[model samples]
Target: MLDAAQEKTFQNDILDKIQSHGWLLGESNKLNKQLVLYPEDVIAFAKAT
Candidate 1:
């Protein structure tokens, strides 16, 4: 689990990347109601990868 500060930093980094790139598709875990980066996001990261 991330501490408060770590969580904030992590969220900021994600927001920055999304702003620079495009929208990311996230998958939601119904059990915990937590969202995670989806496979589609990884594929969208790079075209040559």
Candidate 2:
């Protein structure tokens, strides 16, 4: 399992990738909110992005 610092860095990395690609939209924000409670979704979203 990732430490808190690593988890935060991972989340920021995902967010940065989304922002850098200009792919974030309303639905993506909703998905990100879901990610806070369901971290596994991050991997799926990252793959999709």
Candidate 3:
């Protein structure tokens, strides 16, 4: 299990990986949830591969 600081580091690592793979990150539009979504192009790319 990760401590608070270690958890932050892990999150950053995952985000970096996502960006490096051409995935997107952004704030959610709905008030009920907060999240980042990987855009459709990333899914298309993966399907093509």
Candidate 4:
């Protein structure tokens, strides 16, 4: 398990990568605790990076 600081850094890195590729990062839903990403967004991200 990640420590608090490690988790924060990991999240920040993911957020930065997503935003850098012009993709939105949705908040995790309470029920599933998963972040939402559209299929096209992922494709675009893949092509961009």
Clashes (N, CA, C under 3 Å) per candidate:
0, 0, 0, 0
Cα TM-score per model: 0.43, 0.46, 0.55, 0.46
For candidate 3, lDDT tens digit of each residue in 1-49?
8999999999999999999999766555522333344455457779999
lDDT of 4: 0.74
Per-residue lDDT tens digits of candidate 4, residues 1-49? 9999999999999999999999766654422325445556567789999
**Candidate closest to the true structure, highest TM-score:** 3
RMSD of each: 7.6, 9.7, 6.3, 7.0
What range of 10 consecutive residues in model 4 has the weakest lDDT sum? 28-37
Superposed model 3: Cα runs more than 4 Å off: 29-49
| Predicted model with the maximum lDDT | 4
The lDDT for every candidate, in the order shown, is: 0.66, 0.70, 0.72, 0.74
**Tens digits of lDDT, candidate 1, 1-49:** 9999999999989888996787643446422334444555556667647
**Which ranges of candidate 2 are over 4 A from the true structure?**
24-49
Tens digits of per-residue lDDT, candidate 2, 1-49, equal: 9999999999889988998998553454444463453355566788899
Q: How much lDDT does candidate 2 score?
A: 0.70
| Superposed Cα deviation of residue 26, candidate 3 (Å) | 1.1
Candidate 4: residue pairs that collide: none
For the record, the alpha-carbon RMSD of candidate 2 to the native fold, in angstroms, is 9.7
